[model samples]
Target: MPAKIPATVVTGFLGAGKTTLIRHMLQNAQGKKIALIINEFGDLGVDGDILKGCGIETCTEDDIVELSNGCICCTVADDFIPTMETLLAREDKPDHIVIETSGLALPQPLVRAFNWPGISTQVTVDGVVTVVDGRAAHDGQFAHNVAAVDAQRAQDENLDHETPLSELFEDQVACADMIVVNKTDLLSADEATTLTGQLKSDARDGVQVVKAAMGALPVDVLLGQGIGAETDMAARHEHHHHYHHDDEDDHDHHHHDHDHDDFESFVVGRGEIEDADAFTAQVAKVINDHGILRLKGFIAVAGKPMRLTLQAVGPRIDTYFDQPFGDTPRATKLVVIGEAGLDHAAISAALQA
Candidate 1:
């Protein structure tokens, strides 16, 4: 029988640069063959495409699978195992596999799936690489405003017994063979150094700490760690929302001051954003309103022929052109996840304004 391929779990909070890091690995991947599984909590598959379009000649069309099934923390057994089997059965089996869990996911359950019957023989968990947003981590571990604080605190309390960012930071650190502090470019040299020290203090002893911006670490640093999946990761340490088993949730949800069920989701389809500033202002309003938690889509911006991608979680937003939209309409399509009974009309008006 062939040797079981080592699978790495790349996990982090929403918008913490997991996908960016993965893309870097794929493009610069050393001779090792790799397959990727991406799970996006958001409704769209923007992250999946970003990883797939690295222009790395090695990635085949079937090499990537995107799973957006509620929260993987609760649904991994249902979606993860079957998918792993499918990947292993491929004719050109990958030498290694990487699983990027949703921002809201917990790594423990996904790690446990390796022990499941039928699939363990073919694949093993190599390591858990957790990415942290250095800027957010240094901003007192949450957004800087009162509203951001209240929103994060409420989300923390309501989910996983209200796991605070500090605790969540600790949990991600405890379970990792390597803890990568990303977005170092957003911080000054001293700030990055200070945050690195704090992360080192929280990580398991002997764990390596790397400063990365846009997940730019060399491929070897990410892969070839050989951490092994069944390692008693629970011994490393500890750390979501009331979600459903399959698709949509049945419970009425609210976090902070907004009613969660009252949230609204709408797609803004404008072909090629002519003015980045205009689009940025519109997005700023949605996040500042505190009604939106996650925003993602491809933008057809003017002057830039490449497809401009947009992603925002809370007050932080990141954008870059990933690829041309090809023959499709060069319009921007975005999904806004906001509080229950969210004012869709208001958002639509602003986005189209």
Candidate 2:
């Protein structure tokens, strides 16, 4: 029997540089043939499109596949397994497979998919890498403030339930064979050390934590770990395990529907904007008012032929001209993801106004 092909699962929060790291890997793949499976949370293929635009010879458009049907973990049977089988059956099979999971995905469920009969014998999980935003971690974005949490607990013993973000972050850390603390450049030495310590404590013993700036890491370090993570599922903890069934027979029908009732995402379309500054300010206002976690998409400025790209994590918005509209319909389209119950009508009106 031939050896199983090695595959790496990259999981992280939104805007944690998963795509950047993948781009870096593709650029440095040397002579190895690598296949990429990109999973996105929303209807738009923003991350996948960004990766396809990387212009790397080793990982071209054909090498990259996007699964925007839903979260990869939830659609493992319907989408993930079929995709892996297709990749494995290729006459010119790839030397390795790299899966960039959606920001909202849990690594354990996806890892469990490798245990399926057809896939189990063909591909081995090289490693599970979890990337953490250094700045967000330091700023208590994912419930890092121990003192505050402790005080709240003391005030109300009933406040024992963890926030969705905290649980998600912890689950990713717990399942990681390697934890990459990315965006370290945004943090001071002391801040980085503190965040790293917190992550190390959350990770299982012997799991290595590496610091990186701008998702820069050697290809060798990220791959070839040979972790065989599927067998280690007993040791890796997950927050949603109770909601899952142990029987493989039930997995196909089990959706493992993620509890996303608190989150919402919607697309906002507009005609070409007359004032770029005004549109940006309106976006900032909406983000601030609604506590948006992520906002990104292309925009059509009245006079510019090139498309304007807008990305925001929290209140920080960055804009730049990525490329020409190129005959594609030029319009302002932004996908806003935030807490549920966001007034879409008000938001669209504000942006259009």
Candidate 3:
């Protein structure tokens, strides 16, 4: 029998820089073949698209797999198990499998899925890497805006336990083999130290909490923990009971009442834009006005062949040219994520105007 492949599960909240961390890991994969199973929470596949356009040589088209139906944790039996089975059956198996889960995902269920019959023999849960947004932690937010997150939680009728946002954050941290506190550059020396200490205490004993900026940690530190997390189920129980399934067969019922119902996302389409900076500024205004949690998509800038990318967390919006539009349509489309009840027509008009 062949050795089981080591799979690393990268779990974090929205805007926590998990994609950036994974891109860095792929670039520094040291010539090893790595596969990515990117799980997206919204209507658009923004995270997978970003990684695909990243231009990292080690990461090829065949190496990237995306699951956009819903959160990987909720769809473990339906989506995750089959994906893993297909990957394991391939002739050219990846040396390492890295899963970048949706921001709202519960790592406990996804990690525990490795114990499934067929999958158990083929892959081992190498480690569960939970990334934290240092600046967000300093700002006292699980999602982007503190007040907005509070508003969303208050509106959730099905919210029986603690606030889902905070519990989700704790669940991610609670299930980690190692924690990467990213975006520390945005924090002051004293602020970074304070945040790190807080996270260290939250994490399990012996779990290393490292600070990073721009997700600049080495591949050695991120992967190869060899902890086999699937076997450590007792220690890594989920913080929120609504997420993790007691059995793989029971996941279908949970999916019907999934936690994602607390939030909503929609894609907004617009015509071509002339100015990238101006467009982003307008986006910033819209985000502030609408209290959007996340907004990321490609924009077709007028008179430019390259596609412009936009990602916003709170009021901070980053824009850049990621790839050429080529034959692809030169139109602007963005997926807007926020707590439920976003005014779609109003926001579209605001961006368009």
Candidate 4:
């Protein structure tokens, strides 16, 4: 049998900088080919497009798969394994494969997928890297109270009895070989240190915690982590009552439930934003009103020729100009991912406000 190819799974909550970290690694990669499987939370494939825009020369069209119907970790056999097999069969096979699960995904199920039959002989579980939002952690986003709300948001009304976010946080931390505390730039030095200390306390002893800015980290540190699924599976806290072994078999149920009318992604591309503060205020209001989890895209602000890249996860928003628009039309193109029936007209009017 051939040596199993090493693959890394990147898991985190919404807007935790998983995609940014992967892009940085790809940009600074030392000639190693990588296959990126992006599990978008919604029905669209925007995340996959963002990954492709990262300019990784090695990753072709087939190398990327967007599992939008449901979380990839939960739908392993149906969503993950077949994608792995497809990548393996390609003539320009990647030396490494990275799977970025959705913000609401549980990493253990995805890690467990590596041990399944079909791809087990072909691929090895290298490690599970959990990207955490430093800003969010500092604000107690993982606290038990908010965790409860997040849990309710992730599932259908029927699953109101499932495990809470506090448990889910432990599950993610318990299963990780390393935790990348991303978006450190958003936190003060003291805040970052305190957050890191709290994270270390939650993580297993000696589970390395690295502070990252804009998801930038040494590629060597992210890859070849050698955290095999079979070796340290015991260290992970197993959730028995909520998710049963048979539950994996009924993945379609999760998908059907996942398609619930909770979240939707829409773009604002008509006009330029004249006031960043006013636009951000409107975004905050929208989030407060309809539970918008993420907002990201470039805003073409009036009087400023450069495009301002705007991103918001939870209540926190970050903005920076990546590059000049040059010849592209100065239009504000922002994608709002939030609950169903979000007042699109209100959102659009606010953007134009």
Candidate 5:
């Protein structure tokens, strides 16, 4: 006799501020219990760990599920379904649920997964929020027009099909209930306006496009969409199937397993950093030199009780401290991700140098 629980799906490309947006939402939940499911593509699972120790009173570690599946959408049957079921079965139910998808994930497959027999009856997708990097958008690094970017790929991949970056960007815009253009602070007035306009034009009619700095949007605006998005997939109109179904009854997953073949990630560990500024500059150099797509993890800074958390996408890097290292060993560990054929040994040497 109870109403279906509301769940918000936050989807975005690499370094689009999905995590920061979710952090802002959690910071302003106003005493509401919000359960978080973090889907990480790499082995380290740093994002979930970041939020787990984020010091948000409402989001305890117990309320967080650190899911390091190969791909969240690809493993819906084996991974996502049971995760959702487990959350709902808990005696102390959360007031709201937030699911953060991997950067490469296409929202359509994940949203469609919600229509499964067990999940559909219990959880309703409140809304799908797609975050875009405003600065990156302005620099022509990312785009919304599916047709335009369909054939694009990392310069050296030499693939015949669409690049995961382009496909993910296009599809994310198509499935969004709302689009958040983050990192506007790094963009000029005209740049922000132009990017927002392009996204609005590309998004579905009536889907609002909002600009943000550091993903700080009101909780009221972020949640409570009540779209029940699964039932409204007809209007969303996915840009690509990216998968195949044997029949109407067959689940759509892993049909396009090669989608991530071009990308790779690995962790680099080292001793504590004595000079954070110099170390950051070295990191920037490595990112630029090797064309690293994403680099994020914790650094043990000398004389600092709290470990430094660093996240980088493209040329932009952000750092902050969350919790202190009480008993855990002090070490600098980072996950370097980029297109396949990256010089892992060379990249690791550069970062660790």
Candidate 6:
């Protein structure tokens, strides 16, 4: 029997640079044939589109698959298993497979899917890489204040104030084999060190916290760990373990209910913007005021023939012209993901203002 193909699972919170890291890997594949599976939470395929726009020869549109129906962790049997089988059945199989989970996904459940009889013999989990947003962590976006939360919990054993975002963030950290602290460029030296130390302390023993700026980690360092995470998941500590067990056959009913009510996503569309600078400023203000977690999509500027891509993690926003709009409709579209109470109508109105 041939050896199982090595697969890496990239898990992270919203706008934590998972797609950016994957793009870097694809660009620096060094002639190795690699397949990519991207799972996005919302309807828009922003991440997948961004990756395909890279124009890397090895990482073509044919080699990339996007799962936008739901979170891959919850839809493992329906979406994930079949996707893996398709890749494995290919005549010209890829050298490596990278699965980028939705930002809201829990890595452990996805890792457990590797144990499925169909795929167990064909693939081995290379490692689980969790990317952390350095700026967000430093700014206490995950929690109101890390120290205060800890102190409150310590003082009052019965007090449980873990928000959905904080719990999700910790679960991702707990399941990681390697935690990459990305967007370090936005952090001051002290802020970077502080955030890195916090992440290190939260991670499991022996888990390494790597500092990265702009998702620029050496390809060699990110891949081929041979961790076999499926077997080691028993040792990993996740907050939801008591509520859920590792049962490959059981469908994740709770996950669907949990995500829908807790996190809300909406699409904001508009005509071509005449002033890009003013529009971006307004978008930034909306994100900050509304506490938006992740915002990304393409914008149609007034004069520029190429479509402008906008991505934001918390308040930090980045924009660039990816490629020409081509025959596609020239309009502004963005997918906003945040907590349930987000004022969609107000945000839309502000963007137009």
Each prediction's RMSD over C-alphas, in Å, is 17.8, 18.5, 17.7, 16.7, 17.5, 17.5
TM-score result, candidate 4: 0.62
Candidate 5 residue lDDT tens string, 1-353: 68899998887655566777777677778898999888754354556666676688898998999666456666789988999999999998998999887445467778888899978988999889888877777777763332323321221122224445656578778899888887787888788888888987988865767777767676755776667888988888766655311000001111221223335788999999999989999999998888675688999999999999988754667789978999999999998876567899999899888
Model 4 misplacement above 4 A: 143-162, 239-353
Clashes of 1: 20
Q: For candidate 5, what's the RMSD?
A: 17.5
Cα TM-score per model: 0.62, 0.62, 0.64, 0.62, 0.63, 0.62
Worst 10 residues of 4 by lDDT: 245-254
Clashing pairs in 3: none
- The residue pairs in collision within model 2 are none
lDDT tens per residue, model 4, 1-353: 66678898887665676777777677767888888887654444556776676556777666777766554655677766787778888887789998887434467777777777777787888878888878777786753134433542455332224565556666778878778887676889899889878887888764667777667666666786555765567788755423311001001111111122333678877577668888778877776665555677888888987889887654567788889999998887888765356788877676555
Tens digits of per-residue lDDT for model 1, 264-325: 46676665667886787778786677446557788888777788878764455678879977
- Please give the distance, in angstroms, between residue 132's alpha carbon in candidate 5 and its true position after superposition: 0.2
Looking at model 3, report the run of 10 residues with the lowest lDDT sum.
Answer: 246-255
What residue pairs clash in candidate 5, if any at all?
A: none
Candidates 1 and 3, the one with greater lDDT: 3
Best by TM-score: 3
Per-residue error for 61 in candidate 5, Å, reads 0.5
Clashing pairs in 6: none
lDDT-better candidate, 2 vs 3: 3
Candidate scoring better on lDDT of 2 and 4:
2
229: Cα error in model 2, Å = 0.4
Q: Give lDDT tens digits, candidate 2, residues 1-353.
A: 98899999997765676777777677777778899998753354666666687677777787888876655666788988999988888898888899887434467888999999999999999889987777877786843243433332233222223445667678888899888887777788798878888887878875767777666676655776667899899988866631210000000111122333445778999889888888899899987877665688999998899999998755667889999999999899998876467888988787777
How accurate locally is residue 18 in candidate 2, as Cα lDDT from 0 to 100? Answer: 75
Native-to-model Cα distance after best TM-score fit, residue 253 in candidate 1, in Å: 32
